[model samples]
Target chain A: MTSNLRFVFYPGCLVLQRMPQYELATKRLLAALGIGLQDMPQASCCGAPVVESFSDEWVYLAAYNLALAERLGLDVLTVCGSCTNSLKRARLALRDPEVREDVNRRLAALGLSVEGRAEVKHLLQVLMEHRAALKESVTAPLRLKVALTYPCQVFRPGDVAAFDDPLQPQSMHELVALTGAEIVETGVEHECCGSTLYTSNQPLALSAGRRKLEASRGADVLVDSCGNCHWLLERMQRAIWAGEPHKRLPVLFMPQLLGLALGLAPDELGVNSRVVALLGRDAHD
Target chain B: MIENCTHCGLCREVCPAEKLGGRTITSLLSGGDEYSAWLCCCCQLCQEVCPEGVDIHQVMMCERRREPAPDPHRRSFENVLRYGYAFPITEDINAMRSAHGLDPVELISAEQVRLLLHCL
Candidate 1:
């Protein structure tokens, strides 16, 4: 593992406010993999999809966070798919001279400017980049069957993310495999989890989540990388599953599973006993 | 970019919103109602599969700016304006972070955020 691999961690608003376990698990896993994480000072939202809808000035907010990362002189690493997409889009948009100039002028008011120096990488990209270190770090191979819920924004709009196949994503499958877990093909891995849609239409969003959960019934546990996906698929499972608690599948963030494989305690990675019990055996066994 | 839509309906075929019986890129391209723009989950699949490089996400965003934003989106924008985050962060967040053994985040003040985003 390259001990010098460091990133300014950008735990987007969703994770910061709603998903502490995801944050804890990600930080724990990255540290064990020899990756250093530095918190961005005075960082705020990347003005996620919500801001993009009402104003072109969303670029300003995204650039604002990027400029903050630039101040630290390190690439930004994010755990949320929406933040990854919003920040990457803003970086691309900043390449336009006029947009860059305007954004700089606005940022200058806060003593910040974005030169497009910092790159934004999602957690999946970071894990895939350190596959060798990850494979070596796995002390307890998770033998459970796992189904993946791919974060839509993390891989799609191909040109921007540009890391994996947008339609048929294999990076996650390959990364999860390094943990010695069998990857189950649920057929709905690429579908939207509908977290964004929940804002406008609750029933439709839950239905989308329900579809994925139903499709993954064959698997022992469902794994997701994005906070939005976890929120709908895991937190809202009761509402989506509706009175069939036994039918509900255990959901774990990508790093939680990886942390377990790395010989970290389930409690340290914020893995609840339910998820541990679903492992069907001691994590080390 | 919307003009480049060949109306191949490939975006419609891949759109989860459309599959779930909501109007989406194909409907918006055909002059569908304003609500069509709000129905997207921001999955970017429609943009990914567009044969003509139509940037359907941008097209939907343009349409969204024209309509009244949904309550959740409106509240999110307000939260950004008020707290520099899409969700409110109170002092207790630091307590939560401490429990998780993570460092407390130093949030930018709303005054600074307001000055930076005054253009909005």
Candidate 2:
């Protein structure tokens, strides 16, 4: 059956710059689940951390991206937690007539005006919405013990992002369970992965990430849904676990793990050799 | 909105920055300028836990705008102004995309970005 679900894929700046694997896996898995992703044309940043910190123009940048998706007549599917939060917050702020008027006046120059038409949903939210389809697509059941690092911005500040329990999120756990993986309780499951802090304070960022990795020693792998979390916890593991490679836990993006269960090839999902090796060992056992 | 803060310290209880010895939301509420607002991880936990509905993130943003932004934030702002993206997109990025069997992304034109962000 051809499902009618479609979205304008918003791969925020971090994903575009640093994580092709996550993007590739997201597209492959979502397609398998009958979700169509149309690329947002001429998409820019969602006015993530930097612009948000220093200027109210962050709303303008985020509104511009939303306007592009609105023009496409589709809701947005964001892969990054920061983008999810930024866009949602901007949408909420734009509800005020004064803010909307000011933003529309500025956006008029680029031939774009946000009518608050496009809704932004993170990849996790989209996946949860299609849980029935996801269950049918899984050809492989990954029985490995998985520790989850929930993306902070995705569900927090409940009034704005308002999807899951802001304090004790369960969507990721529920989604991972569908793949037949065992979810381990890592004490730091809801802790920040320190990606936002990395640019500001490297040592503190590494310390925060290291704490999570060390606390999840019992899990066979760590899974994250946000680009920033994956970047610091997975891509920067070498720096976080310097001189102690054995202490480094394997990390996978949520889609990569889902793609594995969907029977997609590891290479196609852009899963690294370490995770592939873990899968190999799981199979042999 | 800061006026609504009851100083109940619920935000600090869940703040990663406070745990890491950085005086964040609680300090800001108490008029403490010693806090480095840049230390925030932007997790939104503080705002989520605030009983008074204080928009802590907005408060932090206001504080951040008043100070000289950290170097990384400045660079990201400059990159956004120049490329319409937070990070510079070069030919190598497209080359990598091609290798991954993904279509190359066509970024917004610099002129168009300038017009859109002229108010900045």
Candidate 3:
């Protein structure tokens, strides 16, 4: 409710390992906007696709982190969509008294409990809520066109995510609008990036991601916050178009693009390390 | 649960993994080879379009639980078991973080991860 709420920053496993740039850019951007973030004393996977698939125990794993945040008296701000989904799913599942009791029994071993006090939110949800504040901090406007993948976990199962209208998402568009960037209308804008299937079937995942990329051929950049989606659409996209003459649109996290508009250098936002070079005013305008 | 299905096949229409599997949700749910479940990407597209409001993703998740952990996914889980993250915390990663003017990341202690995994 306040302009400057502090949250337990849950940089899910993927962002820390595969995409630290998102964390750096997000932290810097949040700091610039005067939002406070506290690191979790113990940050672990939210028990998503892998653990969630294997056992119901995944809920306990997710609730454990929520309990940690509750103990710290802070809500969680997850940078990864899957982590947000897993944590939210666990929170929702905990609403059933029987399930919460069972999970709490398991957490008892770890000296934790499913108190259900901590709320899990995707970064986009947080930013969208504070777009007005964020807009005031934008020193420069990004003139480039941007297309974004809402990432299934963050948008779908809309009843749980409750961040935006999944069928007609506007949160990302609203957030991007604050930076003065054009949100291009891509046909496959809402398609699943097939990121969860990357490990199961690489070709299928790549093909699904290619469809979205091909659809975004007209946009200057593709943006998404989900690490899995970013990995497929941005990193695997290169291999998907190997040895072919194709448009190379850099896939950026929302913060990276917003960071640029906030007047942070490309290096500070880790844009220089991106697979596709982003051409802004000084770079190629 | 099959009673909830309307046989409209709208879920199949939106599902990428079902397309890859060359099967429909009805077939998979109606005693088809469980291997078809492995093809599911867990994107939840099918769940979104199901007119009957049936969670086809839950069906696929049930199958995934039975299957042996896929190698890559297993490796990622093991990474968390060891380092509280799905990726190794190497010096290069630390340098990259420092280069970005970020503090060194402090992951959940490996001890805690192991204990949690064991308890769960």
Candidate 3 positional error at A35, Å: 1.3
Query: Residue A204 lDDT in model 1?
Result: 91
What DockQ results do all the predictions give, each relative to the true complex? 0.83, 0.80, 0.60
Query: What Cα-based lDDT does every candidate model obtain?
Result: 0.86, 0.86, 0.76
Q: Per-residue lDDT for A153-195 in model 2, tens only? A: 9997787888888888999999999999999998889888887
For candidate 3, write residues B12-101 as lDDT tens digits: 667766655544344565444534565676666677777778877677667677777778888877776677666776446667777767
TM-score sort, best first: 1, 2, 3
- lDDT tens per residue, model 1, A179-224: 8988889899988898777888899988998999999998988999
What class would a CAPRI assessor give candidate 2's docking?
medium
- Candidate 2: stretches off by over 4 Å: A1-5, A281-285, B30-33
Candidate 1 global CA lDDT score: 0.86
For residues A1-285, write the lDDT of model 3, one tens digit per residue. Answer: 244566988888778777878888788788888888877876677886667677667776788889889888889998877888889988988899999898787778778876788888888888988888888889988888898888677877878888787666778788888888888899677777777777767777777877888888888889888888888888786777877636666888888888888887776777754422455344322
**What's the distance in Å from true for residue A63, model 3?**
0.8
TM-score of each model, in listed order: 0.96, 0.96, 0.90
Tell me the TM-score that candidate 2 gets on chain A alone.
Answer: 0.96
| Clash-forming residue pairs, model 1 | none
Please report, as a value between 0 and 1, the fraction of native contacts recovered by candidate 2.
Answer: 0.79
